[model samples]
Each structure stands twice: as structure tokens, then as C-alpha cells.
Target: MDHDHDFEWRPGETLEVDGEAARTEASWFREVLGRYASGVTVVTTMTGTASGESPIGMTCQSFTSVSLDPPLVAFLPTRQSRAYAAIRRSGTFCVNLLAADQADVSDRMAGPSDDKFAGLAWHPAPGTGAPILDGVVGYVDCTVEAIHEAGDHVIVVGRVVDLATGEDTKPLVYHRGDYTTTG
Candidate 1:
């Protein structure tokens, strides 16, 4: 086994390290990473609510397609996220790709609110019972396939079970800590 302790690991940048502390290096690392643009998505799941079942969602930009043969996808959520916990319990989730006009929805879901789904319209995904937002560009229903611990986040690999595509629309993009629409 080769242990590479001298390598400096950053989220989206590579740097050679002499003696810089991780905390001090993280700010610059994060700023550099922000230069990379990424599409915004809301990862949602149905959870037990007082009346019946309600949707819990959180905005995430770390989603990606992992495999095509086995139909795998993945997203990273912070360990402290409540929505991630609900998704884990349900064993299923839906990835809602936001349209450029859906920034309000993304903001609402990303915040720490008891009723994130309040005033939002959504329906259950046919296969997984996950909540799929109405105005998203598309949605992917998935079952939890695997989970790996990564620092303060968990990488959740999901097996895509069902999906739906909506009309062509500008995708919501995040770059440099702000939201924008792609050309």
C-alpha cells in the first residue's frame, strides 16, 4: 500500500504543499473551485408528515452521472443535511434539475426551513415515490445503491430507475457563488 501523505488535496484544485494548514488553504481552494460552473439541482424525497407525506428537498450542485451500463448516478450531500437523512431512510430519491426560472425554488429548498415544500407543487415519481418538482427541466428517480464517506460529506450512488424530461429550458447554473442562466 502506498500512503501519499505529502499530497495536498483540494476540492477542485491541486496544490503542492510545504507546511500550509488545511484550513488556511481551503478559502483559496474554494474560491478557485467556484470558477467552475455547474448546473443546480434539488435532491428530494418523500417523508412522513403530520397530514400524510411531504417532500423534503435540498439544493445540490454536486450531482453527476456515474455509469451507463448499470444506470448509476451520484450526488454529494453534507452529513448534517436533514434531507439526506430522509432520503437515506426512504431508500429512494429524485434529482430535480432546475430551470433558470426556478432559482426561488432552489433557494427555498436550500434553506433550513421546516416546510421547504410549502407552496411548492410536486408529484410522486412513478417508480420511487420520491417527490418530483413540477417545473424542473427533468427528473431522475433513483434507489440508493451505495454510500461512501468523504470528509464532511457523503457520496450517495443511486441506481436510476425512472426518469422524465420536460420542455427545453435554460438550466439554472451556479458559478462564483451566484446563480446564472446558461446561453
Candidate 2:
């Protein structure tokens, strides 16, 4: 017979909140969180092209290094993306941090269509045999450690197998859905 609002659970359902509350809270949280600034990246993987020639495949943002001892990196791909599926099935990828001047490359990889790696300067990274961006601030080549679902995205954890560092490049940042560059 307790009518307390904090009943430890919703009075009559599995969800703690109703639909209206979910939308309201989600929108509020999204707006608050979108204010955070984050670096941009063009994560890539090697694949066979239409001519059966090898090429690097790419997608923008969503890259991070999670651990150093085991040398693990993490990146997320919105689960709905075709490239996400491809990267998952391919079982390997490289994280390429974008230089401030490489915003165009980042945007190009963000798309779902067209060839992404064409003319992208790169060389074979050992272990994964993936293409690491030639001008990136740094690159981490890894094999996936784990894949889990988070919100609307798939959390990908990669165990670093090899790494390379490029010449000093100012990091490209993204905030409020806009690119920011400052030297």
C-alpha cells in the first residue's frame, strides 16, 4: 500500500519511466552532452576493392585508446552502419587520428557511400597488415578484443598489435557538430 514516488521500481512495468519521460530526459541529456568537445579521426581497415586490389576502408570519429598494458584501444560504430558490420566481420582495424588540416579526409570517411581510401597515403602496418594513415598524429593497429552494445552504438575494443606515429599534427576537434582547428 506504499504510494511513494520512489518505489524502487515503476509501479506497474519493467521500464522505470514512461515514454514521455524517456524522450524528455533523452533530449535534455543529449543537448547537455553535445557540448563536450572531442577529437576527430578517420579509422581505417584494409579490404579488397572492386578490381580485387587491396585498399584501406575508413570511417570518421569514434576512436579511443583504453589501455596501455595490454595495449588496447576502443572505438564505437553506430550499429546500423554497414562499415561497422564490415569492420566487425573483418576482425581488424586501425585508429588514425586526424590532423587539423585533414578535416576533408575525416568528412569523406564519414559518409556511407563511395570509396573512402582512394589516394589516401598509407603503408602496411605489421601484425594487422592494416593501413595506418601516413599523416596521422598517431595510429594504433589492433585486433578486436570485445564488442558490446551501448545505447544505439556498438562498443568495439581492440587489442593493439602494432602502432605508428606520424609527424607532429595538430589535433582536429569536433564540438556542437562543427569542426574546430587552432594552431
Candidate 3:
């Protein structure tokens, strides 16, 4: 068989190797990605619990626009998160881009606490039906189209149903495990 091993340190090393390779690929990736800036978002869905049935939302930095014509967006949620499970079951959600001053809200929602939504003012978005948070940068409601399993996270693809941008929008940023704001 023919092969190209341009990037390989030792082209035929694999044939002679017997033990596990010592490397920190995951940590390296995390460190590299920390240098890049990303906007913060809240992915919200209705929790099918016994309580009053309010929208369940979580603060996330993994969200982005996918398409324009059909209107799409994508986000990755950690596979182990309870919020991810509920959102997956509901099959609908909202992506709320946070404003600069909304860091407190984001921090609160990202915790493991049970009552994250309490005292937070929210209004239901029309069409696909996801709650939109006030004092945020913008919002987009979506219906789950496909959820592809990635390594430790699941890539959620959603078809956008509605969208709205606030008048005073300031993007909240995340970098190196720290929150930032657009200056």
C-alpha cells in the first residue's frame, strides 16, 4: 500500500510501536482554543419536569450561525450536562446572546443549582416557542434538526424559527476560562 507521511516524525514508527503514545492532546487543544475569543450564549428549552414548567436555560460559549437562506445555527453541549438532556428531549430551544452586563446572569445559570431561572425576566419567543431573555444582546429560536455525536460533546443543528436583536447590544466574550466584554 502507498502512503504519505509528510508530517510523521518517523514514517515507519507505527509498525515498531507497542505502548501508548505519551501526549497531552486534549490539554493542548484547550490551551490553544483559550487564545481565541467567542461570544457567550444561553441555550434555553422547556424542562418536562413536575414543577411549573418553565424554560430551562444554560450559559454557554459554544454557539454560532450556520446558514442564511433556511436560517440555521449550531452549538455544542457537553454530553453529561442535564440541560443538554432536557433540551434534546424537548426538541426545541432558544439561543440568547448575552450582553456585557449579563455576566451575573450567565454565571448563575451555568451553575449546578436547581433554581437558575428564578427571578430572571424572560418572554417566550414566537414560532418555535423558546423563552427569550431580556437585557441580552440578541436571540434566536430554533427547532432541532439533527444532533451529531462528537467526542465528549454533541453538535446540535437547529433550524431557526425566529430572531431579534436588542437596541443596546454588547457581546459577552469568553477566553481562557475568563469572561470578557466588548470595549
Listed in order, each prediction's TM-score against the native is: 0.86, 0.77, 0.83
How would you encode candidate 2's per-residue C-alpha lDDT over 75-141 as one tens digit per residue?
8766666566667877888788788887777767765446677777788778777777777888888
Error of 1 at 136 (Å): 0.7
Q: What does candidate 3's lDDT look like per residue over 74-154, in tens digits?
A: 988877677788889888999999898888888887777787888899888896667788888888889998999996578
Candidate 2 local distance difference test against the native: 0.69
TM-score for predicted model 1 compared with the true structure = 0.86
- The best candidate in terms of TM-score: 1
Model 3 whole-model lDDT (C-alpha atoms): 0.76
Candidate 2 — which residues are off by over 4 angstroms? 1-28, 48-53
Expressed as tens digits, the lDDT of each residue in 1-183 for candidate 1 is 332234422221223343546545765776898899999999999888779887888888999999998999999987767889999998999999999999898888877688888889888899988898988899999999999999767999999999989648999998887889988
RMSD of 3: 9.4
RMSD of model 2, in Å? 9.0
Provide the overall lDDT of each model, using Cα atoms, as 2-decimal numbers.
0.84, 0.69, 0.76
Candidate topping lDDT: 1
Q: Arrange candidates, best TM-score first.
A: 1, 3, 2
Question: What lDDT score goes with residue 78 in model 1?
Answer: 75
